[model samples]
Target: MNLKARITRTGAILLGKYVACDGFDEQQPIRVVTHVHADHMLGLRESLKKCEMVLMSEATRDLIDVLKSPLFLMAGNVKTLPYKEPFEYKNEKITFYPADHILGSTQVLVEDQEGERILYTSDFRLPNTPIIRSDILVIEATYGSPRCIRNFEQKAESVLVDLVDRGLCEGPVYLFGYHGKIQEVMEILWKNNIRVPFIVPEKVFHVCKVYEKHNKKLGRYWLARSEYAKELRSKKEPFVAFYHMAARRRFIKEKAYKIFVSGWQFQEPIRQVNEKGFVIAISDHSDFEGLIEYVRKSKPKLVLTDNYRIGHAKILAKEIEKRLGIRAIAVPPTKPKKK
Candidate 1:
């Protein structure tokens, strides 16, 4: 059950004989895509060319279908892995658990025939579902800094509701956020019975459909298109639009009030407002306290930090070692050697 970890531009690759890839890439024989985030799917297309098979959650496959991106490999190349079910691969058992990051995100658990367990948490948040014992734990440290810690979930609902209420009074309100955060905001609005036509970008519209397919209705939403934009411009009524951060500026000509939602708002020079709009503190990844708590509860014999926010990983590893007495180390990426 000897395992070695290798980091690539896409993500971490664990190798032995039956390789377990944590993210999208064809560098290994067996590739496991934890989620559909762009960073995790860097070499997805190229990997499909070299790898035997790529494993991912059914939800991820559905997401890829909706995106219709040429970057993704063919459907035949992907093998859907059901959550929490153990599947035999080569001489090892692999299980997928809900990662709580996005709609089909998973935390992979690989167990070798020799009873050695390895857990690779690609990206996760609070209220994780995986509760298994592991010999080695590879965890993400996206927000592994003391300054990043904040109880956002408990406060996000109220803050967003207030913002929406105020924005509706002005003109078309543009809410800028990522896929998962936008969905959460929509759900909050729905549960509060704030019935309003929400204009979403094309990608978000497709993602919402997948959520509905899973029976998670996000209320009334229309895709933002040329026709819809013209119609909105003609109308004199105020509306709400949820858009991806990249496309937020597109609606500026329509006099839409913009608001950027992200956890990074907490840091920096306290920029409450910009030329475009205001910034709000909302995040998906676990904060510093949550990261420490996870390590304490996992109780793994050895801990390996994710390459994301490597500086935070180094600091977090030291804290884990000092606080929990666990053998923690920030795994540095292998540097290329000069020929």
Candidate 2:
């Protein structure tokens, strides 16, 4: 069996005859959307014009709906697939497994007629249950450097609790994070009995509702503009608010105690310290150690790394070859299209 594939730099997209991962193009009729992240959904709306169907997990489909994406408006364009279940697509056996990146993120496993296997992990993190193994492993290297390794989960809740405690005495605690992270933090707070009413942006609230609908039960959270927020603000008492990082500026006037959560907090310098917020190291992707451990567990014959950071994939590939003795290489970005 001859299998040829091309993956983009960030591993946001993969191209092949039977399986197209996370991204879409006119050439590939069957596109697999791994999750609802903006980068992963590239060309989806345009691809629907020509493609037969777009494959994604049900949770992701619901997320697109909550996001009010145009893709949701396209009738019969999206098809939902169950996770960890194998199905035939274009004569190849394909399976989807929980990626543990976000609520509905998944890793694709493909088996050809000859039993040759290929796995594409679009964006993943640790603490995930193992699914199928593969011969050729194409993995994301978002936090792929030795310097990116950090054991934050054990202390993440404590750190946030401490910050919340301190901020309660000062002012409203503003936490800046993405959709999944925000939900996870809220769950953590709830589990710890923090019980503080959380004010969340509209999008974040939508995601929380989806989580609850899926039986995850993120507890209670008020939408940003709801009466709950007005009541909390009018009390002149300290409160907690969760906002997307892009909306950080909206809370500046409130004089809230701000904290930005991300894995790159250590690597990238915080800009405009007086205005921007403090950094809290947190990540959804596997670190250097976790990536190495994943490679060891998968025990793939070939390892391919793709990430947004230049040289990250190459560096990780080198480390894999040195330590694991696997044939590893970094996938270069695809050439730019002509005008």
Candidate 3:
């Protein structure tokens, strides 16, 4: 089969693949942002210049502006599309749905005239998360491994409660994660009636403010650089604070207890910290079961995945075809191999 025949036969395209274009080059990019996590967006700068147009959610655009500095050059080549709106680009009609991963993450769906559709489910979480909507039928799998199943939230919460009970009743509780994850932690605390004065990095706090503007109540916390420092210092009740890795040690003093959250914690320096303090697996990515359910619902003809989870995606595809009798196969990641 010719290249066009192959692409036409299977309605799918990997990250660095071409559809009605030459080989997918970072310089020849099309509108693509599979959630706002750093890993998913590593090469976006190079990719942006390649494509004729760029499309993503408004919130994502705002967050990217904050994340990227001297944002003038990087911010110019994009257009913000509303959620689920059908837009035409590269002669194809496409729609974007909420990925439920982060505040402004999205899953891209492209529909052609022949009724063939391809959905790229950026990293997403099926369970209830703060400030994001869960899509019943998503596409692709970023977390399709059996090891993905975990009870990090429940386990971490129990440990946190115990640690809080043992604390001096007024010491600060330092919790660490990315900006978006920190907001999620704060939301969980609020829902469980674990109210406390919390701290987050200034950048994360800015995003939280955006969430609050949209009326998603997170927590009654102050930015570390914000006013009311005296009030936070004088706090006598339980408190929660979020910081980046660089700021972890300084904020987490001998008196203050520390907690780390993320799937990454199941490994590395995080595991080291878990020995003493606490680590939670509250992730924004889907688990194995969630990934399968999403694939079955979407019913795409072919599958594509990132390198780390490519095998997991392929395994899930096999199970899906066996159970539902659907034709599905896993495709390579955008990059042939990691550098």
Candidate 4:
């Protein structure tokens, strides 16, 4: 397939015909933001100024309203589209499919007037992630390396529950991860029937509300500063407190047990960081095998491995070509831009 495929230095995938996904290009009249990740918001301001319309899933738009200022979405040209429902623009069709990444993440499909299809998969995971067929595939390689496999992925949730259960027996338990990740842990604990109340900062508490509003029901949680939470903190009753990944340093391990969430673990899912602390492997992204499986199942004639910002896109593309016999190449990161 000689389809137009390339990523701007700022990590935006450009179809060059109708739209730009995950990044901005002044040349395209349409801009599609796949998720709320900071990297994907590159050139957003410019796109909003230049494009006719900027689009995202409704959940993604709400996430921005919560995590970011809502002023961005109040723009006239910004719009939301339903999943599986296509919106026709000029001579193309665009649609968003739910992604198994964060709360509102999605993969985008663009089909031009010629009936040629292009898919840009923002970060996603497999076994559950939907596979969309297209002539050209643009995929994320956050775990694209051959070594980036999660053998304990299926058991990660169990391990997390066990660790937290054990930690509560001693004292307060502290957990750290990104915004969406923290919310995900809430679901895992709730589904397992762990009813222990969660105490998080005010921001995370708001994030949890958004999750609940979207029908992503999480368990009982309280704001860290609330009178109830403060009383609970003083009592011997053990509870979990969540923090953003950057707060790892602010954590005082001598006071309580800590479980750091990460997906980079290749050998052991649980790694001992200190006597009272450990790192557990749990990621929202598809592993190396999952990435290959996606391409194989989708059967795209050409694969564009996105390495513009992170992941071993070059290695992943090479692996795809060798293992699946599919033509794949990494999009070079050029003229990198800040979020």
RMSD of each: 3.4, 3.2, 5.6, 1.7
Worst 10 residues of 1 by lDDT: 330-339
Candidate 2 TM-score versus the reference: 0.90
lDDT by residue (57-160, candidate 4, tens digit) is 88888888888777976653889998999989988888889899988888899887778788988899997789999789999999999899888888989999
What's the lDDT for residue 64 in model 2?
85
Compared with the true structure, what per-residue lDDT tens digits does model 2 show for residues 109-184? 8887767678887777776746447788888777677777675556766777776677778767888888888888
Compared with the true structure, what per-residue lDDT tens digits does model 3 show for residues 1-339?
112112111122332222221122433346455556665564466556666656678777777767765463274477777877887755566677776777878766666555456555666767542221221222445556556565454565655555544442647777777767777767777776776677777787777877776567897878777667446766545567777655676754446667777664333322435434666566767677667666656655544443333336566656667775765554442324444
Candidate 4 all-Cα RMSD: 1.7
Q: TM-scores of all models?
A: 0.88, 0.90, 0.77, 0.96
Candidate 1: stretches off by over 4 Å: 1-10, 22-27, 226-229, 251-254, 267-271, 308-311, 333-339
What count of clashes does model 3 give? 2
Would you list the C-alpha lDDT of every candidate in the order shown?
Answer: 0.72, 0.74, 0.57, 0.86
Predicted candidate 1 versus true structure: per-residue lDDT over 1-339, tens digit per residue? 124444544454563345556544444578777877776665666557767888899988888777766355574377899988888978888888887777888888888777777887777778664545678888877776676677555776677777777778776788888877788778878888777788887889988998888777688887778576658747846667888887766766756567777766444422347554777776667778878888888778888876543337777777788888998877654322322
lDDT of 1 at 52: 80
Q: Model 2: C-alpha RMSD to truth? A: 3.2
Candidate 3, superposed: residue stretches over 4 Å from native: 1-29, 70-75, 127-140, 151-170, 234-238, 249-253, 264-276, 308-311, 321-328, 333-339
Q: After superposition, how far is residue 181 of candidate 4 from its true place, in Å?
A: 0.8
| Positional deviation of residue 158's Cα in model 1 after best superposition, in angstroms | 1.0
| Full candidate order by TM-score, most accurate first | 4, 2, 1, 3
Ranking by lDDT, best first?
A: 4, 2, 1, 3
